[model samples]
Target: MATPEAPLREILKSVSFTQFPLRVIEPFFVADKIVKPRLYIYPSFAVHKETMANDEKRPMLPTFDVKSLYMLTALKFAKYDFDIAYTSEPDASPDGSLPFLLLRDGTALDFKAIMSKLQQNSTELGCATEEQPDYISDVDGDLEMPKNELPSEPVYRTMVENNLLPVIEYLTWTDPVGRECIGEGKYLGSYPQIIRNMLSWIAATDTAHKLKLGLPEYGADAMVLDGEVLYENAFRTLDSLLVLLHTVDDSRLFLAGAPSLLDALVFACVNVFLYAPVKSPVRTALLKSDSTYKPVLEYAVRIFDQYFASA
Candidate 1:
């Protein structure tokens, strides 16, 4: 009789990893089954503390990473079930990214693949159980947009994706104060001094390369990488979204009823800006001079209180 490991043996013959541990590679030779799907994500400071032994219980912590937060919100909206695993190592994922889903059958899924899978199985999935929290959207509830509104969804989504998301990334990764705040308060807090310093340097360099933000002047304190254009575009996008919020009737609870995927996306970005321990120019503008943007902020807050405020 042929075994599943036979093909794996042939495949591994040509693969070499001198530094990789044999214990890690040994799993590939076995056919153990994973019963529940698991979501691998960057560690959250609040979650880390909450799950610590003998620690007092606290309100469920919101996701610290933007991608993790939005993906989590979307999963909750879809009423999906999966276990959460906190990890700092992105190399464990097939695509070398955090927030990937490891399925029961050992298949890994990136964000787009996970969302596509949910859509394909929409009818079969999304049935909220008694154990599920009531704060989430009703699976049977209507979240469909009007026919005319449908066409505009993609446009607004693009505005948020292209403008708003980049600004968040710029602020969090490129801005000196923002990077320090998150690195100290969340991502690197648990690591020892030496390791933390090394990882922080690597993260900063990687982020600069990924976002194409030129480095600050050498030895210059309080200098920001050129983010003027990013901030300008972000404000324009915010103004446009705020105008749309004004046009909507007061009866609606969110930009869309029951909070569509776009709403979830917006909520994730805005909430981060509002609550991040960093000095966010966008957050300052929204709260100070641009009072017109308050409605959008209110919308994001409402979504948070409804779903993520508690576990």
Candidate 2:
């Protein structure tokens, strides 16, 4: 029952590439040509970063679903090589649109079918979980508890007492079901040392990578951008993210310990600088043989070992 105009509008809104500037958009437009079969592509947080940098009027947090789609589109485009036109001048077409070609030999391709396949592939790649009998048992036991008396709060408080607020907060915020499990005075301390090991690895890798890129280091207590006090009044956002992850009762509820929106955000923010061709001296220092990140690398290895062992 859908008309051509309605479907076109829907596709445009769903892709949402226009939210970004020309620099980020150019890569995607070029990639789209190589993808073939004429599928609509979206942008990722990397593209969003450019928008945030170039347009002062852009929203702080654009829709996550839209961004996710855009990332997927970019990934697909990365698989191919194609020439594309890049321009800062706004499109002056009927709907102010950028033109793209569809790879069809006088036959309309099934966009819906292609999208479904891509979604399935993406989920499979992102959620490569191993079987954890013991962890599964523990999770089952927790789920069986009475609704009014889950043990999340007490455990959360324990984490707070042990100076584990960052991990706890990260878990709680990232886990969709955490809002229900979190209670006053409750801290997250039930997770094994392996989880802590993973946190250490993440923090260490992030720090080392940032230094290698000659970017400003992120302090545990504050956020400093280019040595200027951008967010003077706010607490360290990364710390908060880690706390939410640690405090949440169900670590696997949202994306279930796999790469979700949070992981994507963290990866893009921390690792994007590495994609550049030239390395910075600061980055060199962080990645040196005698670097401080040796402990973090070890921790990551330990966490991965635990994960595999428990599988």
Candidate 3:
């Protein structure tokens, strides 16, 4: 698979890791039944957790969105390895989105499709559900058996609507300070000033449009008064999720003990909330460790360490 001229890394502050932008790369296709996907993700940033980072060193940030986190984590659980490429223009994707999977069959799968593909191909690909790992048993292990099976769609709906979507929109679009950093590449850190500002506008407008559709409460007209409330809702939702995790005999650590799409969504939203590109009151609450959201902050760190693989 040959790549077009990738964006120069020398000017990119010498990224510790790099991914080929899809616009600049043509993926490989083969007749081989066994295939490894080429994963396209949002740009990688630096992970600096004042409360979460106990060590002196910081590691490169992984996939930027929750779905990407989920997809990568799900692949890890399925025991599949993939080639990764990062690009700021997820809009250029066939589906016009981020966190997509390009397979050897020349198939492009978005988040849900990626999950379906994993579960469908697990047997041929040799996943834990088919041919057990050295650990993570199928039927006998005490540890939660890691599989790619999905959770309830309603759970997905509730989380995204009340928890993830609003908060992401609030932070990325409605807030002015956050907008400045995004436009300036303080978060993505890969584009020219004009391109960065353009990407920021696209992301903000698209998310804001989604919020507008679910309007009245989230209407664009209400952005000034109600937008900040989205952060509060996100924090409370985190605490609620914590309660759900504690109360239910759900899967260990994650919603189902194994890495699934649901956890990916939750992790993406909460992770970005605590470590937004620009600091705000919501971030302050999580950072204080005295606030009610301290446990949720801790949970974010636990998942990051477990899945993101800190260097």
What's each prediction's clash count?
Answer: 0, 35, 4
lDDT of 2 by residue, 1-311 (tens): 55576666778778868667655433444432232233222111222232233233422221122222233323222232222322222233223322231332323223332333333332221211244222211222211111123234334333332332222222222222321222111122234557644644454445435433224445453222321221111124334434554554323322114323233333222222222112322223224578543332232233323322232
Candidate 1 per-residue lDDT over residues 1-311, each given as its tens digit:
66786587788887887856766543546654655567787765343432232323434445678888878777766656667788876777777777888766567778776655544443434433456432113333321222223346567877899988877776665676766667544677678878877877788777678766664553343234357777888889888878778777433456755455677678778867765655467777655644767777677767777777766
Off by over 4 Å in 3: 1-35, 47-58, 116-157, 183-203, 213-221, 248-252
Q: Can you tell me which runs of candidate 1 are displaced by over 4 Å?
A: 1-35, 45-60, 118-124, 128-149, 190-192, 215-225, 288-290
Residue pairs in candidate 1 whose N, alpha carbon or C atoms collide under 3 angstroms = none
Worst 10 residues of 1 by lDDT: 135-144
Name the lDDT value of residue 165 in candidate 1. 86
Measured against the true structure, the TM-scores of the candidates, in listed sequence, are: 0.68, 0.24, 0.65
Model 2: runs farther than 4 Å from truth? 1-70, 73-227, 231-235, 244-256, 277-311
How would you encode candidate 3's per-residue C-alpha lDDT over 99-139 as one tens digit per residue?
Answer: 78776556676776655554444343333233443221122
lDDT of each: 0.66, 0.30, 0.59
